[model samples]
Target: MAIHPTAVVDPAAAIDASASIGPYAVVSGPAVIGADCILMPAAIVMGHTTLEAGCRVHSHAVVGDMPQDLKYHGEVSYCRIGEGSVVREGATVHRGTLAGTSTIVGKRCLLMTNSHVGHNCELSDDVILVSGSLLGGHVYVGQRAIVSGNAAVHQHVRIGELSLVGIQARITQDVPPFCITDQEGNVVAENRIGMKRAGFSLAERSELRAAFGAIYRDGIGRNAAVQYLRGAMTTDAGRRLLAFYAHDSARGSGMRLYNEANAA
Candidate 1:
């Protein structure tokens, strides 16, 4: 480990040989830093946390702080950062509460500058929290999703896979996969760009487009619409989208358009 002379690292902390600690960084008790991770100046890694290999903690970021929950009695919860992730400057990731038990940032995720991920937040692989986003306690974000800058996700909300949350939105409910939650927290459109980036083929994309059309444009009800799409549009993207509609409907309500045209 390349720890700067000015940094304070606890003797009990486990630092991998390949990790680099910058000037004035503080690594407190029971923390584990993995190989090739970088802790920039004045960053703090504390509590029972683990930073996986290739993670980057920028200046003044704080990880593994106790949860903000009133019921938290200092249980030994954790903040787990996965490999190749970036916790940007002044970001704060708090540990989970006894009820939820852990805050997990999956591989290749980005918690942007000044963002706050509260207790029990589960961010899946490739999830991106843009600068200043605040995820309230118990929020779950699925893989490849993007929570845009300054958005506030209410407690227990889930943002589904490949979804996009617009800046400053107040997200109080689940967002379905492959959908775009606009600044008003309404499902404005399908996340077509993100799907393309995730290697969805043209045919697959076409199938999803059809399914979305069926659900939002057709006069059919939600369950009947999903059933129709299942029979008519059979592709990987279509199946995924259908699954999102079904699961999200059961999980909790998403922001549904009042009119069919508004959904499209």
Candidate 2:
């Protein structure tokens, strides 16, 4: 372990031999620093936190801090940064609010500068929280989703896979898969560019477009549109969209679908 003289690490903390702790950093209260992890200057990893292999905690970023919830009564919660993830400068990731629970950041994710992940948020692999974005507690960000700069996602909201949330958007409802939201947080269109870059086939993209048309353009109500697509969708991507809608429906939060009437 190449720990700087100015760094403060608790004797009970587990620091891997290949890890590096930079100047003025603090690793306290049994936090586990995995192999090849880097804690940059002034970074803080507090109690019950675990930085998996190859993770980077940038300067002034804090992980595993206690939940900011009133219900948290000194419970032993956890914050876990997955392998190869990067927590950028001044970002804060809080631990879970309930005892024995964890706030999980998945592999290869990026928490951009000044972003905040509240207690119990679960970020899936390849998720990106752009600079200054804020995710409320219990938010679920799907794989490959991008929450744009300064966007604020409400508590318990779900951002779907391959979706792009516009900059500074105020998102209060679940965003569906393969959708791109406007600055007003309305689902404006399918994420054609994102799907293309993700290597989705032309046929799959066409199917998704048709699916979106059914929901947003066809004027058939959301329920009728979903029922139509349930039996008509052919491609895997289309099925995934349907599955997302089904799951959201099961949650009973009643996500508002953006249609022509709402767009006006």
Among these predictions, the greatest lDDT belongs to: 2
Q: Pick the candidate with the highest TM-score.
A: 2
User: What is candidate 1's lDDT per residue for 122-155, written digit by digit as tens?
Assistant: 9999999999999998888889999999999889
Clash count, one per candidate: 0, 0
The lowest-lDDT stretch of 10 consecutive residues in candidate 1 is: 255-264
Q: How far out, in Å, is residue 118 in model 1? A: 1.4
Give the TM-score of each candidate. 0.90, 0.93
Model 1 ranges with Cα > 4 A deviation: 218-233, 248-251, 258-264
Q: After superposition, how far is residue 187 of candidate 1 from its true place, in Å?
A: 0.9
Off by over 4 Å in 2: 219-222, 248-264
Look at candidate 1 and give me any clashing residue pairs.
Answer: none
